[model samples]
Target: MSTLLSAIRSLIFVIVLIVTVIPWALGVLLLSVFRRGDPIYWACANWLKIAIWSARWICGVRWRIQGMDNLPTAADRRAGVILLSKHQSTWETFAYPALLSHPLAYVFKRELLYVPFFGWAMARMDMIHIDRGRRAEAWTKVLTQGKRLGAQGNWVIMFPEGTRIPRGQVGEYKTGGTRLAIETGLPVVPIAATAARCWPRKSFLLRPGVVDISIGRPIRPEGREPAEMMAEVKAWIEAEMRRLDPDGYGPPPSGVAGSVEGGTASGPAQPDPLQALSQPPSRP
Candidate 1:
């Protein structure tokens, strides 16, 4: 699409997001005074669904999932797991709740709770917000909340790569998610999402495309070292990225990276930014 058209659509999406978020947040805030539990989550989730739907219709962004069974279900009854995913763009952050059946308790940086109406609404959700400047305190907060939330069957989602990398680029994966898993004795489900296919990092321009989400089987934290577990998580996600979109990650010989199964190309047969990244680095 032309730059002019892309910008116009992005503008429309922004307007839609703003309009959707404002009233929903206000409602959530008011409802918090009386209603709690499922009502609050659904109210917020409805806006997220609308946000995700708008992206599909207005910005031409869609998604594919290869491993839905890997995620926790409502029947699990709070047998919460930690989700460690690859971070590449902002799309996955909004899409995850809409995609999953169980409510997710995201472990995010505290700054996001201040993002005007949207942030204000997020602050009311049963999520963990940490102060990065205080590493010790942050770790403590994660451990406490992660354990409690997981036991409640709420999956704690974190991007091991603390920040979003440009499409096809790899970032340093951290062990925080793995550490939480180890501490909480919950399993870790690794997800590889290619959200950047339609949405680019640090840009409003979106191209029409499908996002591919590949979920790896859960990794049990029993007697697992945080570093080793994280290494495995990073390896799987990156390897999956290469498999899903060999042309974007390091191009191996035609039969090499592209040969890996389940790594469907992002954006279907078409293309755009975050070409192969599976998920967005939340709150960054």
Candidate 2:
């Protein structure tokens, strides 16, 4: 698509977001006073569903996912897992809540709680929002809240890279998510998403294309070191990313295994360029 057309589509999607979030946030605030936990979480997630739908309807950004069977069934109340995902764009952040079956509690920076309407609603939800400046206190909060939320059967989703990395680039994966998983005795599921093919990081321009999301099997944290466990997660996600979007990463360096640096795959590409996920659709 042309730059002008892509920008116009993105603008329309943004307007759809602003139009929906205001009223939705207000409703969540009011509902929080009367109800707590699941009700509030689902209310916020419903708005996310609308956001994802709008992205597909307005921007022509669709997604194909796999490995649904790898996750514990929604009926398993005693089972909880920590999700460590490859962060490329805001698309995954919004799409996960709608796509997944269980409730997800994201570990995010505290500053997001101050954003106008969106942040206000997020503050009310049962999530982990930490202060980045205080590393010690922040880990303590994540441990305590992660355990509590896990006990409630809510999945804690953390971006191991800490921040969004550009497409075809790998960021330093942190051990925070693994630490929480080990501390809470929950397995960690790694995810690789190629949202940047259509929506690049730190940019609003979205081209029409399909994003592939591949969820790896959960790795149990039993007797595993946080750093070591995180490395495994990183390896799986980065390798899967290369497989899902080979054109994005080009070819890995000769000696370096799964090294994606210095490669570039930008702009919209052919629709559903890769094969569909082998598993049957668990959820629409």
Candidate 3:
């Protein structure tokens, strides 16, 4: 797609998002007084579904997912898994709730709760938000809320990289997600999404393309250390990313480092101005 056309479509999609989120947020705020839990959660998720639909029809951004069978079936209420995913763009933040079967609680920064209508609506949901400055308090919140959410059949989703990495590059994988899995004794499901192919990190100019999302088999956290388990998760996601989006990875351009051991591509991190706006409201 041409730059001009892509810009136009992205602009239109942004408008759609704003137009939809206003009334939806207001409704969620009103409902919070009377409704709670799954009812309120799905109400917000429904708006996310509409957002993804708008991205498809307006910006021509599409997705193809594999490995639904890898997740626990609806009948398996006793089973719960924490999702550790490759973060490339804002797309997956919106797409996960709409695409996945289970209700997702995102581990996000507490500041997002102040994002006007969107943040206000999110604050009412049963999700985890943390003060990143308070490391101890944050971990405690994650453990407490993670166990509770997991027991309730909601999947806790976190970006192991901590922040969105540029396409074809690997960020330092954090141990928070794996630590939660180990603490909760829940398995971790690794997800590799190529959303950046169309929606590049730090930019809203979405091009026309299919984002391939590959869900790997769940990795058991029993008897596993957080760093070791996170490394394994990182390796699987990075390798799978190469397989799913070969064109995005290869020899790095000038001044960029090449792939390291365990399939991690090293490079300078890009600033995500949209981090505050694009982050899905909740706790991971």
Q: Pick the candidate with the highest TM-score.
A: 2
Give the whole-model CA lDDT for all candidates, comma-separated. 0.77, 0.83, 0.82
After superposition, candidate 3 runs with Cα above 4 Å error: 251-284
Name the runs in model 1 displaced over 4 angstroms: 252-284
Q: Name the regions of candidate 2 deviating beyond 4 angstroms.
A: 252-284
**lDDT per residue, candidate 2, 1-284, as tens digits?**
48898899999999999999999999999999999988888888889888877888898888887777678887786578899999999999998887787889999999999999999999998899999999999999999999999988889999999999999999999999999988889988888899999999999888889999877767888888998888877766776787778899875434333321211122222122344533322332
The local lDDT score (0 to 100) that residue 30 gets in candidate 2 is 98
Q: What C-alpha lDDT, on a 0 to 100 scale, does residue 87 get in candidate 3?
A: 96
Give Cα distance to truth, residue 197, candidate 2, Å: 0.9
* Clash list (residue pairs), candidate 3: 106-283, 106-284, 107-283, 107-284, 128-283
Q: How many angstroms is residue 29 displaced in model 2 relative to the true structure, after the best TM-score fit?
A: 0.5
Best by lDDT: 2
- lDDT-best of 1 and 2: 2
After TM-score superposition, the amount by which residue 279's alpha carbon in candidate 3 deviates from its true location, in angstroms, is 24
Clashes of each: 11, 0, 5
**Superposed Cα RMSD, model 1:** 6.2
User: Which residue pairs overlap in candidate 2's backbone?
Assistant: none
